[model samples]
Each structure stands twice: as C-alpha cells, then as structure tokens.
Target: MQRKLSKATTLLFAVTAGQASAALFEVDPGPYDPAIGSFAAWYQDTHGRTLDLCLSKNVSSRVAGAPGAPSYMCSLLPEPGVFDDAEPLVFPTNFPPEAFWFTADAAIADAASGIDLTFGAAIEAAFAVEEPAEGDQISFARIRIRVDVPTIGTYTVTHPYGVEVFDVTAAEFGADGGRAINMTRDIGIGAPKTYNGALGGDIGPFLRSVNGPYAEVNPATGQLDRFIGDPNLDEPVTGSPFDTNYVRIQGPGGIDLRTNLFAISGKLSEVVRPTPVIVQRATYSRSSGEAGLSTQQDVFAMAPPPPATAQYLDSAAATVPMTEANATGNWYGQSSANATPPATVEVSADNSVAIPNSTPTTLSAPLVDVVSIQRAEYSLNSGQLTLVASSSDETEPPALTATASSGAAIGTLGGDGATKTLVTGISPTPPAKVTVTSASGGSDTEEVVLLP
Candidate 1:
C-alpha cells in the first residue's frame, strides 16, 4: 500500500562514495493510472488559493454493510466562504490549475461529489424529523448543509432542510450581502417529492418521510399479497430514492442568497458495478394430485445471467487514448492509448533471469513480476546491495513500495504477483539503482544507467 525506496541504495545514486551526505533518496509515483483505480489530486487554483476548491479523486469508499460492494470511488468538495463575490468561476484564469489527469470520472465526480459530500457533512447533525411511532414503517430522505468560515473554523448546525420550490425561494440562510452560488439548473433534478416511492405526493428536503409497502404484487389478487404458496411478509420498507441537485447558500447573517452555486449528478458508480460472474436461482413447482394413478411432469429451464463488465468504461474503449477539454482547459486522459504497455519480466532464484555479468543493461523493459524479485543484491559499475519485497499486504491489488534516486525508472505491474516486468527507457550512464519492495517481504534490486 506504500511506495518507498531503500536508504542506503538511494544514497549510492545521489553522491560519490566515502563522503558524508544528507541527500535523501525519494520515490516517484508517476502517472497514477486511474484505469486501475488509483488516487489523484487537483487544486482549483494553481497557486493553492485559499478560496479555491482542493479536490482528490479515485478515493476508495467502504459501504457499511456489503463487503462485496464495489468501492464507490470518487468525490469533490465545493468550498464556500473562501471565494468572494468578485472572484470569477472560470478555469485557469480564476480557478486552480489541473494537477492530475482530467477524465470524465474526475470532472463528473467534481460535480456529483459536492451533493454527496454535502449530504455527508449534514448527516452528523441530522435528526429524524420526528421519532417514528412504534410499528410505523417510514423511511426518511434528507439533504444537509455544512458551512465553513476561515480562521473561525467550520461550524455545522442542523437546518430545517427544505426543497427549492419552483417560483418560490426560501429566505436567505446565511448573511446579508453574502453571495449565493446557484448550481441548481446546472445539476439539480426535478422536484424532491416526484419519486416518493408508493406515497404519491409532494416531497421536499427534510420534509415528511415516505411510507411504503415496497413490494411486488401478486398477479392473481392484484394486491400487495404474496404468491399463493409462498408465505412471507411484504418486503421491508426501504426508503424512497432521493436525488439532490441544488444547494442554497446565504451570507454570514443569513441575509444574501445564491440558490444554486454548484451541482453534479450522482452515479451508482462502483457501489453497484456488475460482477463478472453471477449466481441465479431457478424455481420449480408441481401441482398436487389425487390418489393412485395420478402422474405429474417436471419442467426444466436454463437461464444464464449476463457476465459483469466495466460500468464506467468499456474494456476496449478504456484502452484507447482520449483528450478532453472543459471550461478550465484541455487535459490528457487516462487510456491505454497514451500509456506505456506494461512489460513482463522473468523471476528467478539464480542467474537465469540476470543480465550478463560484464555487459551493460539498457532500460529497454519497464515492468516486472513480484515473484521474479527474489531477495538478492544487484551490482552496478559502482554500487551493490540486496533488495527485498513483502507480500504481507493481503488487500486486493496489494500496495507496492518502490524507491529510486533521480533518473531511476519505474514500471507498472500488470497486477499483484501476476508477472514481472522491467521499467524501460532508462539509460545506464548515470548509474542509478532502483529497488522495489513487495508487501510479502520479498525484494529486488536492479542497477541501470539513466542518462538525461
């Protein structure tokens, strides 16, 4: 889960031998491959503007119940109070510069995350509109607000949550002369109550909870009854789905207003990503017959579930290069098209996979397998040392730790322990040493010349 380099080997690449040196060897994690779900950071402003939004993408989400749930992977925060009314909302000129890959995931998340994250910020201070009377099956949907003031710190207080009414606007919630940022039209959905499950009525944020018999009806009875022979209560009262698209802002004293400053669409995203394999159950039924010679026939049927595939990007399209431009600027997208194809390296316990003893090794390969990296020492024209990697990290797609001095090349593995590959294109002129450590405590060292 971590990327690091050895202390001693890093020194070998930085300074001449036999002299006291303080230069530290550093690991360079280049081109975070979002294809494999890696994290990337972005700042709305290039110079770390306090008022601009700082965003991180490709973060992993842990759902409370489902261990097998796809990680809901991404979010963006819209920071208010930081920006003054005079500040423009455009990209580059008034906003932060791009620091990472600019893909649909990042951009869309930039919008959607605001709604989800805002709801998240509101969750803590949220309380049931009213305690449910015993035995009442009511599911509530809510939209919460979080406000942060610099120096004074962040303060989240419960608000009487309400939905934006067409032709009607709620009183300002913040301060006088305060600016309101409206993202409602840009990202907001239809009225809050439009989809209140079975309860056909107007629904608003923090309004009345939805009542439900969220179940399938029996065809014969045309009612919320169970199948003839099957006896079970109606499905549990799952709350109605809520769509959030608008956020209202008010100045300091709850005076001025902006109805929708920002908005983004919500995605089922990774949480429900389809699986490659699915198990489906088939039910069979037979009728009862009277006495002696009665006979019955059994019917058999076969139905195979579709294979799960990538939800966001198709396998083929994800491999193709893409260039996208938004209001901010053009960004290089993540796709196999522009990426270096991973290399495959051979692992060995002896010299079987080793380079010639006296011949120079060119950085032609740029990928390696974790297994090929046995605990061993590699010597360059000047320096030699043993490197080890570990497999202790049992997390799927285990974390990799790598270290190298300046000019050292790094390779991307196809996957955990699948195959070994060398990082390619590094020259042998600078005599740099690269060490890769695994989560399982195994290590490998390769010394190569890296010329600029």
Candidate 2:
C-alpha cells in the first residue's frame, strides 16, 4: 500500500538535546518483490525541526525486523543502546512480487535559534554506483545529502544501501564498504544472481555458505570452492557439517547455531547419493568364448570425484542476489575455477612480517620449505624438521608447518612448536635468511635480525 507524506511526522530527527524522547521517525525494510517496493518515514522534533525520507527498491532481505517478516533490528542514531528495547514495524509478508517504496514527512515546530521558514532551501540529494554490484544495466548506488541551515550549518544525511545508515568516513567504497549507486528508469537489475534456483533464483546454493545474504570473493585465489547450496535456505539443514561463515543454519545433520566472517564459494552441484557404485562383473562361463561378440564387461566406474571441497566468500548486505561476476568486483567473474582467487586478508602487528621461519629447529636448516617465491607458501630449514605447507592465495597470509627430514616426527613454528621451536636455532645476534615460496613456484627471502 502507498503511504503519502504527512507534515506532523517530518521533524522527528530534530529533537532537542534534553527532552526529545517523543521524537517520531519512519522506516520500512522489505524482502522486496520484483514489482514495487518502498518505505517512508517522518518525525517532528520538540524543537520544531522537520524531517522526511524514504527507502525503496534497494536493500537486502531484512536480517531481523522487516515487513512481512518479524523485526530483525532497529535504526536508532549513534549507539543502539536507546533503541535496544525498541521494536520494529512489520509489513505484509505476502507482497505478491512487488517493489517497496517509502515516503516520510515531518514538520518543525521549534528551533534552537530564531529561524524563519522563508527562503527555504530546495531538497538536495547525492548518489553513486559501485562497479561490483553494477550490472550491464543496473548500478548499486548509494545516496548522501547535506543541507545548510541557519543553525546546524550544513547538516548531512546519507543512505547507501537504502536500508541501513552508513558510516560514511571511507574514501573509495570497497567491498562491504558503501559506494554510490545510481538508478534510472533505463537501468536494469544486474545479472539475476548468476546461480539459478527453483524460486526463479534460489539463494539456497549461496545462502548455504554465507554468513548473511551476501557473498565475498575468495581472498586466497578469488576463486571459489564448491558447496551444496546457498546458506539462506528457507530452512537450513540441522547438524550440518557445513562451515559457519558468521552464523549457522540448521536442518539436515544437526542444528548448530554459529557464524563466520569468511568469503562464500562453491559450485552448487546436486549429489545423487544412494545412487550406487555399480560394478558390472563378467561371470566367465564356458560360454564366455561362445560369442567373442560381447565379452566386454564394465567395472565400477571411478568413484565419482569425492564431493568437491566447500568454499565461501563474504558479501555486502547490498550485494544480495550475487551475479556470476564477482560482486567484490575482482576479475574471474566470480568464477570458482579461476586460479587467482582473492587472497585471504590477515592484518598483523607488522604488515611487513611476510617471510616465515623454520618449522622445527633441528640439525638441518629447512624443516618446511615454502615453495613459492611470492610467499603463498614457504619452506623452513627446521634443522632436522621440515614443514609441508599447502598454500592458497598469496596476497594475504601463508600457512606453514615443519616436519623432520626423517618424515616421521614434526615440529611447530611461529605460533607454537611441539617437536622444536621454529626459530629456536636462529642466533640471537645475527639474522638468518628466510624464504617464502609462492603458488607459482617463485621465491623471495628476508633476513630477520635477532636481538640479545
């Protein structure tokens, strides 16, 4: 239903510092339909301030408080402490594949200074589009605004995703970071999230792996590993062994409520288990020779490849309904098979601590050898030990281990060591040469100076 703008409710955001508890405001979130969707809000400040706003057509499925669904969250200013107990409004659950539109209007009855409504300013707005969400036609745009006043002097208002208030301090809106989204009648929605589903676009495949409705690109390689379905299933499987990105969905295996902050990935392939490994054995009866004609018997086919590994990437709430192309806007088109998956990002006390140390301080030098020169992986001369590190993307952090040259015992390094300390043998006075191996087999080394 369309709610027109009203004056009394407009100035809700303009409450005076001391007693604006009754300040009114409006907001509407939706599990939008392809048709028409929008939300409108208004409020009047006790100080006689007016406000009006609307969010429609652009937003992710509400995580909690949403129309048609139960309240998921509230949108109070600054810290959410005040609105913690506040409840959100609900819209009709059955929107019949329509869009969402909201309109808000408020009137100001008071102000801190003697103000005149005369020579009032015209409405102002700002918008921009992100390459990640921008499709052949559609652009993931965000809107921001600032108005000059006789009192507040240039007040600013912005809504990037249209649903959530943005922390607009960032420069170039990166993934998860809000960017400008431009919309026009000529623009079209980006590719219907590349993956397909029974619901015209089943989020089941992606939701099955996501912490929320969004998906992040693989930081390690920017490519993706395979999974069963989307994590946003209408009903998640219980006891599921699935990795929890940020939160868990329960259904099949068991109900384990958990979450993760990693990227979501994987090719959603159907597993027809209980199908059977058929072994057509030939009973060589004397008749075997009778007709050399059809003596061919089929043996059990190679076990269908062990189900593919699971992988996932994190996505922006605005990036709901991901496309075949990387929503993070990296190349590879969000394709899983690409070799340069985005590398995993890990910030450390030292961003320059790139090279790894020996796995075990043994008799030999390298306990583990990071093979890549780019540092995706490295080999450590753990004296008698060696670490066999399986590397992923090189840009982020590299995994390492040190095992004995005997191939029997192993040692830990850096974090902890069971056999021997990775750096135990390095001299405290002089630095040693440490090398890191890249996925491509290149090598780079660093000299870590030890101190007494």
Candidate whose lDDT is highest = 1
lDDT of 2 by residue, 81-189 (tens): 2211223312222221111111111112113322211111111111123211112111111112211123211112211111111122223223432222111111112
Displacement of the residue 83 alpha carbon in candidate 2, Å: 29
Q: Which stretches of candidate 1 lie over 4 Å from their true place?
A: 1-151, 155-452
Lowest lDDT block of 10, candidate 2: 346-355
lDDT of each: 0.22, 0.20
List TM-scores for all candidates, in order. Answer: 0.17, 0.17
Q: What is the Å distance of residue 105 in model 2 from its true position?
A: 30
Q: Residue 144 error for model 1, in Å?
A: 9.5
lDDT of 1 by residue, 62-159 (tens): 12323433222212222344212134433212222112111011011122112211322110100122221222112112232232221111122221
Model 2, CA-based lDDT: 0.20
What is the Cα-based TM-score of model 2?
A: 0.17
